[model samples]
Target: LLTVIVTAAGLVSSELRSGSAALTLAKPISRAAFVVGKLSAYLLHLLAATVLGTALCVGATAILFGAAPLGDLLQAVALWLVYVLLLTCFIVLLSCTLRSQLGVAALGIATFIALSALSLLQPLAQTPVGMADVVTAAMAGTAFSATWPLVTSAALALVLLATALLVFQRKEI
Candidate 1:
């Protein structure tokens, strides 16, 4: 979350407020390419942080939880990276549109809260139709669970990037 807000707000808002944004905007590069390039750099930086953080988090979990399953811990870390990248696109997009650091930060944090809700939505959407039925239902299990999450998240990230490119291109910032 800090990665998203800081990168987005610091990049666009500073330039926009200082009147230097026009120089970047006036560059010959396509806006989409510009956003893509910036996002790529941020992602590279994030990947490094993710690697270090995940190692520490998992190692700590291993100590606290006892006999932590290494594979599962790694899987959890990978999923987290996907989630972070997904949120990054939103923060960057809103920052591009609003051109205010505070606004961008608020938008990023708000979206974080919203999506964290959505991540829990599958469970919430399940309810017993009959009063006698259990309120909780078990999700259908599938071998695809091993792979589908990363794929689904990657696809969504692509959509967000496309949307950001389209919106950012038209944005005055």
Candidate 2:
């Protein structure tokens, strides 16, 4: 998440601020093409880094602990990748509107925290309470019992990315 936000969220804004956007636009590439190309490159970079990092961590843990849960680790990493992709979409979208990478990063972190907190609603509601909590807890637990936070995050990410693409298309270079 930090890597995606730091490196990708500033892709367009940084270029524009540096006056390189105009030069790039002067080329035959359309704005949509540019956005797609840059986003693709960033995603590819993310994939490579994530794979390498996961491999290193797994190897280190196996060597050091001798009891690494490789399957569980892979599952966790896959779920985490979903999160990274979602966050990347958000950061890219924010970059379209925000001029400063710092601002985007701050907002991105805050957004992540807020979204993550949604998962707690279930556990928090489940906490024992004096009678009034019983109904609330039941409701909260049932609401998400059939759903996963990752799915929710993915949906939100897709929406954010689509909105960002629309906004970026209309935004002034």
Report lDDT (CA) for all predictions. Answer: 0.62, 0.67
- lDDT, candidate 2, residue 69? 58
Name model 1 segments beyond 4 Å from true. Answer: 56-68, 123-149
Estimate TM-scores for all models: 0.71, 0.77
lDDT of 1 by residue, 1-173 (tens): 56556666655556667877677768787777777887888889888987888789778877888665565546555555666776677676776677678888877877666655554545522211110111111111112232444455567678878887888778775
Compared with the true structure, what per-residue lDDT tens digits does model 2 show for residues 1-173?
55566777586778767877779888998777776677779888878988999899988988988876566556556656666777777887888787787888888888766655553565533221111223233334432221244556567777877787787778877
Of the candidates shown, which would achieve the greatest TM-score relative to the real structure? Answer: 2
- Candidate 2: what lDDT? 0.67
In angstroms, give how far residue 68 of model 1 lies from its true place.
4.1
Candidate 1, which ten residues in sequence have the lowest lDDT sum? 129-138
Per-candidate clashes, comma-separated = 0, 0
